[model samples]
Target: MSPSVAFGTDIDERTKAAEQSSTDVLTAPDVPWNLVIWNDPVNLMSYVSYVFQSYFGYSESKAHKLMMEVHKKGRSIVAHGSKEQVEQHAVAMHGFGLWATVEKAASGNETPGKGGRQRG
Candidate 1:
């Protein structure tokens, strides 16, 4: 008797089901991800803008806008892509001495904006 008969299951059918499950996992829907840059006291605004431009190859205007967002808001979504991509971007940002994180894009609003502060 076959092992399937011993286990009271159709071995071929079970194998097919397992294969389908594996295929489903491989072809699963794509979920967006974001690279969030957080504000810190150490870096100057010009340096942050330059990092954004040099690292992302963003234009001066765009880099300035993002830097301002980081200053006015507590954090900014600097990049968006697959989980691995965003994670890499966050790591690159950290390498540039910036605080950064990677998180799911569509799950919720991760941005926390604090009113702009006057630093004397």
Candidate 2:
């Protein structure tokens, strides 16, 4: 005796196929990655702003904006590019004592340290 599992009986074939494939869904577009900096108590706000200005060569005002976003928003995107470029930015942020990581962009183009502007 066994419970029934039918093809067209509400248990769709697509669900079964998805279960078989242990891969991510393909909704992600051809978007560049992002460098994200999470706020931490260790790094002073001034130093964080300075890091953005020094490493990314952002202007003083632009750096302050990104730093404020990271401070108030908990996290802010610091760079945008391919996965490799974003990862390098993350590593550099780590060197500056800021918590950082890289991930696929949520939107198409959103850069933090670069003043929320996308660079080609």
Candidate 3:
């Protein structure tokens, strides 16, 4: 009679642990990100305000306020969201001929809508 060889019994347990760890990583919540608009000499202030209004559906006054912030402060965090969302906003701003960039919210110098309606 041939002897039966026993394989390692912990293989399935190890696999399940590995899978749970990977799942935890995959399901982790996205970190907040900011969409920053930079002041550029090319785009007129009115155009920047217009873009803010039309694209983000901001009120005229709010748009103007943010535009002024960009003009005076040299930059403004126009919106906040997940990294992917902010990246999309950056692409749209680029399409509008605006200088825009995304950064982790924690690293940003200012928060979006410091005293106004938060746009996310």
Candidate 4:
């Protein structure tokens, strides 16, 4: 014995629409991402600044400024780039023992420092 299922007249159209929407979601354009460093009790402030300098090639003053932002504000978006680029930065930050994360840049928000400065 088998049960039969009925299909609605709009089933094909609905399926096509769903497929298209899924495709759109899958192929969505990549947006700029931010590499945010979060303050933590584990890492020293000097070490954090060093990571910013050595990793991102930021000047001593600029690195110290960003480091202070993290120390005072609890987090700071230190770099901005394509999703892949920021993700790679996040991984490198982790390797340096810094708490870091990547997130989509908020529309209209100013990114810290010169935006999209590629790591040297």
| Ten contiguous residues with the weakest lDDT in model 3 | 1-10
Look at candidate 3 and tell me the lDDT of residue 72.
94
lDDT tens digits, residue span 1-120, model 4 = 111113347645534443333233223364467778998888999999887765555667778888998999899988766676667667667767789999888875756645323222
Cα distance off (Å), candidate 1, residue 3: 50
Q: Compose the digit string of candidate 2's lDDT tens values, residues 1-120.
A: 111223345544433332222111112234367778998877999999887765665667878888999999999886666676566556656766789988888764564544344211
lDDT of 3: 0.66
> Between 3 and 4, whose lDDT is larger?
3
Q: Which residue pairs come into collision in candidate 1?
A: none
- Indicate the residue-level lDDT of 58 in model 4: 65
Our model 1 lands, by Cα RMSD against the true structure, at: 17.8
In order, candidate lDDTs are 0.61, 0.62, 0.66, 0.65
Better of 1 and 4 by lDDT: 4
RMSD of each: 17.8, 17.1, 17.7, 16.7
Candidate 3, residues 50-112: lDDT per residue as tens digits?
A: 887766656677788899999999999877666666676676688778999998777535655
Give the TM-scores of the predictions, in the order they appear: 0.63, 0.66, 0.68, 0.68
lDDT of 1 at 66: 79
Clashing pairs in 4: none
Q: How do the candidates rank by lDDT, highest first?
A: 3, 4, 2, 1
RMSD of 2: 17.1
